[model samples]
Target: MLNAGGTPNISGFLVDAFGKHLVALPGSQRALPGGTAAQPAQVKFAPEGDELLVTEKGTQLIDTFSVGFTGYASPPTPHASSGVTPFGFSITTRGYAIVSEAGSGSVSSYDVEDGKHLNSISAATPLGQSAPCWLVTTGDGSFAYTANAGSGTISSLRIAADGTLSLLSATAGRLSAPLDMALSSRSKFLYVREGNGAVSGFRVMPDGTLEPLGSVTGVPPGAQGIAAR
Candidate 1:
């Protein structure tokens, strides 16, 4: 966990399942020489279980941490400048990291082990979808879905075996601001949290399409995060 809002010296924490404090690691003083402070927005372990990827929202960079958090590497401008604001990311079973770029309204893929840029699919390329803030991948790692906040839609992309990405489809999402998303354990369903404090559920079709199952009401306000067990 990153102390994103901390001042002077940002830090990372090693937490346990029960939310117990385990270890605290210090963050780099600066993301780049004489650059802005580092503010980590999201952290995810690589699918291969050997590396960690952290999104520095403040510095617009991705920080890779070695296994056991023993080493660190900051890739200078991993994603395109258009997609600099990396907000949410998901690792594919094949060890590819898919990151949602809110600034550029695109989704980018990277090699989890070496921090190499793989490919990027724009939500605005053929479709007018924009501001994809969050993403979730199918259990099989064959497909990915991003919640487009600006266009209020869901953009689907097909993930090739070699970690390449291609736009598949964009469908209307029944929400104002789709912020976060999660896939069911078996990848049978997808749940999205909207800005209106409602959770919308969709059935994940075999062809990587979404079938709306309506929304769940009565959720608390400002509910922006969700996960499927």
Candidate 2:
């Protein structure tokens, strides 16, 4: 878990799924860039599972770390992001990194080598939306979607085999303040969490389009995360 209270440090814990318990390991807290304002938005494990990547919005950097056996992370090596306000991101099936830039309302792709070195694969590709705060990629990594909060829309993009990106639809779907997003385990359904305390579902079409599956309301206010299985 991240202690994201305007601090640059992150804490790691051990989880016991069957017991629904969390154990904070000593010496698991590690500092990132911008000591007091890293504003790290998201953390993802590399495809190899031995490295970690964090988006530092405050510093416009992507921090990479080597994970130790005890779940502790090494001192991070920071790389400048391809765009501004890097927020949500994911690793592609080909081990490339796709990131969403909230400030620019665009997305960028990177070649992550050894889970630590990041080489820009493609420059920022504008989705022509606003505040794309969350991103999700299809299971095959051929398609990706971003929830544009400011524009109340979802944008789609195509990911090439070499990690290059191209805009698909800047307004794939329109909703109210879409924030976080998740894909079903089978990658057949997409779920978007709205700022209005509601969760909406969509059927991912064969051509990388979205078909509304309606929504469910009554979620607690301020909820910001969703998972699908």
Candidate 3:
């Protein structure tokens, strides 16, 4: 397991089956430009490789870890965020990474191998979506989805051959403050958790659209996390 610390360091932990920690590895500090402390908000491993991608909310940057988790490498290129804040990201099976920009209400794609920014799709205003805090992609890397908390909706997108994002559909989620999401193993179902203590499920369509599967109510209020098997 990897833990993001307040000091902007990442610590690795080895745990046994019983969920007990067996060993704690030395923490590694992310070297951001200008030596700014990038408070790492989320981390995801490459879908087909050993690389790890981390989102730095404070500095609005993405950092990659070398294979075998040895060292940190700043992206070969720089991404001008224009004040957009990156929160969560997911790597695709096709060696691409998609990051959710909360400040800009958009999702940007990048080449994972070289950290090259490819294209970005706006999920706000004209698209009728806002504040996309979390993102998830299909196992085949054909589609991607964002949980738009600001507009209480979800936006569906299609991944082109060259790793560009094309908005497919943006529909009202009918949930309050949808924060986090997860997908079923076969990528047929999507489960979302709302800040208002509700869990909603959806059936992913062939065209990357979402069909409501109702929701479970009465969950303890302030529930903010979710996962799937």
Candidate 4:
């Protein structure tokens, strides 16, 4: 997310067919809101690919918009995030939005109707951890994980069929200032980016538990985000 002339904007990019070229599409930028304190911490497209959900920290809200065929966006529809300082989130196949609330150290879910309207399905459900800022969910949409930066821990939760969440483990794994996370293509492995110059790996168990796979050190310090393939 970029602050475009004091407004939060989502930029568009184009990649060449050969995957050797990339370019910014300036005209495709969609401005979320202007004249407000909106720090978009994370953005994810709905499973249908016709909508986008952005967690705004500064405004403590989640903004959703309908995406047009040409990549333009409809006016943003703001919704209470059901918690404070909403950060990373994932939209499930059933149109459920699961979000991590850093300020409240909890996770919440909502029903995103037709990519715009939002209704809370679950209030903030605490995991007894601190600063659970970044989140990732299973491909099956049955579980979710959050990296607790302040507590140096990872927490797991079972995402119910109705978009509710239940804490599975408060300390599923440990890291040093975990900031961002990604899951493997099969959602079998989970990786975390640590502020302490390392990325830790964990195996995803059948019951939503995490088994430590150790850490890869020597990553540049202050690395903020990560992706796994």
Candidate 5:
């Protein structure tokens, strides 16, 4: 790691997407907080971009970079708050973030993370959404969905600036214990895994509304996650 602000040294081995071993940068410094051991819940590389995220406690934050993955220009940017428990997060094609709130079972939206946390519920609006176990963004990043397992369905919302959501017309049909979902690579379809080992498919409309395509014939039990080509 190169030095600009705080001297950063990677504590772990340098690896690529396939976990292949790679030689370390000469005389690298570990990235750490001032006088404290760094605790990172997650670490994602931004080869095409120049931003990083590290989750601590229940808050997810942003860490900026210079050239390569080094220390931040300043401190981390706190993306969201009121996260009863954040289990996971996903970024859209447009660079916006959809964070999973495991506690409230809702997903929060954020443009940037500072000390001040933005609205917890971000999609079509704020203070109107509910439990979102996980989220999947479209290729355009204009829309996203939350697996509302509490109500056994999915909550569809459109993302707005300042981490706000605008509820779109035509809510999707019911999904029992929906935990996760995936958008088609072409952004024309969605497949969700519901409780009781059922997979639901929906035709993604241009207006960000979902039209149920119907469930797959039969899947194995304990279906939890999915991906599409």
Candidate 6:
């Protein structure tokens, strides 16, 4: 947990479940680059190590932190923004934490700099389906896929060298109320969960499209949450 309850409208907390005690972790915050002072809506740990990346104020920007037993160290630096609502994040094997902004349906890439944000990946058009809620990237950082809950479909995109984006097609496909997504280590399989209590698995294709593998029932009872394997 991070940045919970740090705002007047919210309570952000970083709690660790060590042994049996749910110890509360210290809370840290900054004014924000967007100047809106919006609350941090989401957070993720780096795939390579303990580095932490967080989205502030509806995915307007990103921040990093180092972890220690007593507490976490200061963040590396404030990364820039893609002007998208970063609702979720995923780390690639190449050492980039791919962040998803559900509001604008885009993804932003960052390289660690002096424990701060130093550089950003330049993307072309926005990534994935419109208004994606979360995403998963490939092992080599060649591709990124997302679950666009707003359009009730999934979208695929190719990651550019500069970190910009290009959609594989103008449209992805019809899906359930997708919330979160998960990709397999081999990148051969993908998963998406719906707010309406449906789970699905898909097989990957050469052109970055999906073929349904299987699905399940008993998802959520409301239009609130989703998950993927």
Q: What is candidate 4's local distance difference test score?
A: 0.86
Best by TM-score: 2
Better of 4 and 5 by TM-score: 4
Residue 51 of model 6: what lDDT? 65
lDDT of 5 by residue, 1-229 (tens): 3222333223323555576757554434345332132223334423244555443323333333223444333333344344555544566544555666655555566553332233344532332345666677677777777777666767677776544656553246576667678888888998888777778888889888888887864677765468887
Name the better of 1 and 6 by lDDT: 1
Q: How many residue pairs collide in each prediction? A: 0, 0, 0, 0, 18, 22
Candidate 5 achieves a global lDDT of 0.55
Pairs clashing in candidate 4?
none
Error of 3 at 35 (Å): 6.3
| lDDT digits (tens) for residues 82-104 of candidate 3 | 23678777888878787788878
- So what's the TM-score on candidate 2? 0.94
Write model 6 residue lDDT over 8-99, tens digit each, in one string: 12112454556565554445443343334756666666664456666775436677766454445563456556646666667665566666
Cα deviation of 135 in candidate 1 (Å)? 1.0
Please state the error at residue 73 of candidate 1 in Å. 9.3
Give lDDT tens digits, candidate 1, residues 14-131: 5565868576556533232113476556777677655666675666666665544443434333333226577778888888778777777777777655544434433323334777
Question: Candidate 4, TM-score vs. the true structure?
Answer: 0.92
Task: State each model's C-alpha RMSD to the native.
Answer: 3.9, 1.7, 3.8, 2.0, 6.9, 4.1
Better of 1 and 6 by TM-score: 1
Work out the TM-score per prediction. 0.79, 0.94, 0.81, 0.92, 0.64, 0.75
Error of 3 at 3 (Å): 4.7
